[model samples]
Target: MLHLDASSSSNSKAISDTCNIDLNSIIKIETQLQDNPYDMISLVFLLYDVPDTALQRLIVYQRVMSDVSETNINLLQEWYCHASSRPNWQHELLEALMICQLNSIVKSLGFHIPTMRVFYLSSDPFGSKYINPVKKILYHACENIDSTNLKKLKKSLLSYDINVMEHTTCEIIFLELMSKKFITINISQENKTDEGIMYNVENIVNILDKLNGLKKIVNSLRYLQSKPNHDTIKLKQDNTNYGVDDFNDLFDLINQIMPNTLENDD
Candidate 1:
């Protein structure tokens, strides 16, 4: 149904050809599922892919879940397990597909689905380290201002698998949506104190400085880790020493900044 036409190079033709086959396979699989909702073999086969089948596979699963009654829960669970055991990209795609389908089902059925429970029970691992591909789907789904559901979804997102940049992007989108629908936080100017103001400013500056240092360390570590086959033992030892030094410096800085507080505590 969706055509991918990118005429950048010779490989474009090959990709298009593969996509055509993928489309046909998706159609056949959908028809089989519709005819026999219990067809686990066809469902499992859908998890397999060739080059350029990402979009095709996503479309097929979307169509399949558009009509929830056509899906077999047990078979879907098995398919999730199969997908999770594959590469990270495949796992991310499966997560996005599941979120899309669950949103559709919720809208159609006018009820909330326990997506978190389903994910946990299916043993589909999620965390902040993994990237989320369905952020837009999630953003739109929560636009209805169902506070209860939104709260639950927010908690679930803690384990919803997103990288640092994606997490920031999603938070911005969420804040924008909430701004449009709800009142912003209000603080009275009369309640401000000079001591409190100074403390808050110092805290903010300290946090920013620490974050800048941490970012540098993370970038350096990423570069070093990516270098092919270097002395791994030496690298590990160097990193361990680097981390210990950073922690010591951090603690010393904290002690210097809050010496009076530490004395009072003692």
Candidate 2:
């Protein structure tokens, strides 16, 4: 009888330990997202509980941009956590974004850490609305094969890490996007920033020049096309250093830069 009691007690302790670990993990996620996620990336992936009347109007104003999926949102948050911690986390983001159909919406979810706010704003505030025809090349590249395609894309994406810093490299893609010319943005900066967070003409010109340098590989047709110099951008995510929450920062930035861009809830 004593042995049976001991066994049950041991089992209960084990279960309790497991539960505690899981709970801690969940709390960690909440803290990371809420408290100090901005140190990792300028753009944040998050949701808001605020009244949606204002957000809904923005959606209607924008011709009902595609919906952001819950699964992708979770995946992005997970990726953000990993990317903030581990350097190799980009593979997960690239793969997830590739498989996720809600790329358009996913692209817009940037968070500010200070206030725990979420905003939908374009990253490229001043680039032209131009596109490279071969972007489909990347899409098709992923479609034609099996594990090999995934492997190749992973390799290609990860290859950028060979020279550039981990998370900061993602900023380079924004420059690449501008070079492709698929972006046109109008940003209003009430005040100036040393970071040039606003999308003004000078910002556009500086980005274009820096972007061209990154893609200027010797004689290679594949990547010779202009790409943003991944090395130029610095990463901002650090738990130790405090800043605005990803969600709030994005909202404030968008609200400040493009006040009319998002429709008011009322």
The lDDT values for all models are 0.30, 0.27
Provide TM-scores for the models: 0.19, 0.23
Q: Ten-residue segment with the worst summed lDDT in candidate 1? A: 195-204
> Model 1: per-residue lDDT, tens digit, 38-125?
2332223223222123223433444565476664333344334454333242223333334334333222222112322243123322
lDDT tens digits, residues 64-147, model 2? 223433121232244344344522233223222223223332232221221111221123211111111122222222233344
Candidate 1: global Cα-lDDT? 0.30
Off by over 4 Å in 2: 1-81, 84-228, 231-249, 257-259, 264-266
Error of 2 at 85 (Å): 1.7
Q: How accurate is candidate 2 locally (lDDT)?
A: 0.27
lDDT of 2 at 244: 24
- Superposing all C-alpha atoms, what RMSD in Å does each candidate have to the true structure? 23.3, 20.3
Clashes of each: 0, 26
Clashes of 2: 26
